[model samples]
Target: MVEWFVGVQVVIAVLAGTAAIVVGLAGVKPNDYTLGATLLVEALLVVQLVMAIIAPAFGNVATGSGLEFWIYLVSAILIPPAAVMWGLIERNRWSSVVLGVACLSIAVMVYRMSQIWFVQLA
Candidate 1:
């Protein structure tokens, strides 16, 4: 995986998480801005997924189990859309909280993915 690409992902994750948290704390239901931010993060995740899939062809193989890394990537990509959908269905402040938690989870997952990409397992 590309280090710079991973860095970009990290930054996006942080922004996404922060946005979610702020929206949640404001005690509003998921609105256009929150949904848009979720979608934006989802878009970035799709890009990251594509880059990850093609990285080995470009000779950027992960030192850990490829399966584990792919699983993390796929999970990360799914979180935002799922959270948004759930939030829309719930239609409450708790929905915003759900988005916040999902975003935070994505942030941690991305960090773990980076470790999997750059570190070798014994």
Candidate 2:
């Protein structure tokens, strides 16, 4: 994964997650605002997937275990959609909280992926 792109993903995920949590705390139900934010996080993950596919061609291969990185990326990509589905089905304030938690989880996963990609064993 690209370092700068990973940074962007983490920042956006954190911002979106925080916003969703605040909205949830305010007793807001499942709404477009939270759904859209989750979608944005999912989109970035899709982009990261594409980058992973092509980055090796550019000599930007991971420094750590490729399997571990792929597992993290794949799991991260799935969390947002699952959370969104749960939110849509439940239609409650806690749904927004779920989305926020999912985004935060994605942020953590993405950071782990970055570490796996860029570790320099000396």
Candidate 3:
């Protein structure tokens, strides 16, 4: 729900997406940097998740309950790891592209999560 954190996610997603595209155009196969991006995003999402918990604990009530918040939390936790692991299985630069897509998707999700948290209405 933090405005600052949503900005962070957008920045991360754009940077990661750019790298993924550049890597794809270069024809190098996927490498450790892809994993690096995964880790970077995971760190950001963890920030979001922690903040999500704290906001309500501090009595910042949303129209929904904490469980709704955790759905986004769990989704954010689960999706990037799955994408990173899938990139490992696929083993192509194209797979990095896929991971980048996931990164962008998470950014979108984070924004949506903020809306779910911040807006007064459902």
Order the candidate numbers by TM-score, best to worst: 2, 1, 3
Lowest lDDT sum, 10 consecutive residues, model 3, at: 60-69
lDDT of 3 by residue, 1-122 (tens): 67887888878877886787678667756678876887788888888777776776777666655576678779878887888788878887788787778887877777777777777475
- Best candidate, lDDT: 2
What does each candidate score in C-alpha RMSD? 1.4, 1.2, 2.0
Which scores better on TM-score, 1 or 2?
Answer: 2
Q: How close is candidate 2 to the true structure, as a TM-score?
A: 0.97
* Each model's backbone clash number: 0, 0, 0
- lDDT string, candidate 2, 17-110, tens digits: 9999999989999799899999999999999999999999999989898988999999998999999999999998999999999999999999
Which residue segments of model 1 deviate by more than 4 Å? none
Residue 59 C-alpha lDDT in model 2: 97
RMSD of model 1 against the true structure: 1.4
Please say which candidate is ahead in lDDT: 1 or 2.
2
Give the total clashing residue pairs for model 2: 0
